[model samples]
Target: MTYTSRIDLSDHVRKQACALLQARLSDALDLEAQAKQAHWNVKGPHFLQLHQLFDSVHDEIEQFVDLLAERITTLGHVADGRITTTASATTLYGYPLEATGGEAHLKALAGSLGAFGKAVRVGIDQAGTIGDADTADLFTQISRETDKQLWFLEAHLQAH
Candidate 1:
């Protein structure tokens, strides 16, 4: 249910933007948890580097989670970020719990980051099409950061 707000957008537009934000919020929360999992479980020769990188990724995604949830509330909708909600709503592939090595965690995380980045890019366009430039800009900012984080993860997977 949408609460009354002084924001200029119509209920329809706000609802659409809130739905989009909610979906991304779920993904962000799931992604954050996956990063923490990698941080905690990573082993092998590159353990230190991989562990630090995974922690950093988790930190960044925590910010994204707050941003997405706040945006939903700003648009006058409740942001449901519970783990059960995220488990059910997230579009991201499940992180591999069996992944214990650097390469394994890296690959798993890169896949998730790639998927989240792709969805956020779509959200940028969707928000724009729905006439909410602010929401679109928020998505744009997130997409850029997600791409950078994906690059960091992919770099480790590269043989060079």
Candidate 2:
């Protein structure tokens, strides 16, 4: 008797899922960096609040990054963590770092969350086509979480 394990199923589906994962990892890192930026450089009225919120956002993203990384490795693929790899892999349109005020800072953070949500939605679709239900579920979960942060970040931009 012999025991063997394979990703099984269509190559198209697996390939597509892998591609999505790669992009997701990149997006995750970009968002992570954005959260860090928000934590470090935000100033003005809501500084402490915004700073704490950014840290929370960073922590959640760290969790998701681990989940996605493991899933990638489980599928016989490498999880990219190097700066160069993350820079090239991210589909994100770059989160700005020079925004000094609270409003401007929140506005900038919103863009990264928006991009991450979009990418996760794409990942969900790709996972579905590839019959990777678990991966699809994870993407969906990330999308919802990202949406929450999006709302929170945007809220800071409104006058209160």
Could you say which candidate leads in TM-score?
1
Lowest lDDT block of 10, candidate 2 = 1-10
RMSD of each: 0.7, 3.3
Instruction: Report how far residue 136 has shifted in candidate 1, in Å.
Output: 0.3
RMSD of 2: 3.3
* lDDT string, candidate 2, 88-153, tens digits: 878787767568987877878788788889879888977987798878998999888889888888
Model 1 lDDT tens row, 1-160: 9999999999999999999999999999999999999999999998998999999999999999999999999988999999999999999999988998898999999999999999999999999999999999999999999999999999877876
- Backbone clashes, candidate 2: 0
Task: Give model 1's TM-score versus the native structure.
Answer: 0.98
Once fitted onto the true fold, the runs of candidate 2 whose alpha carbons sit more than 4 angstroms away are 1-12
Off by over 4 Å in 1: none
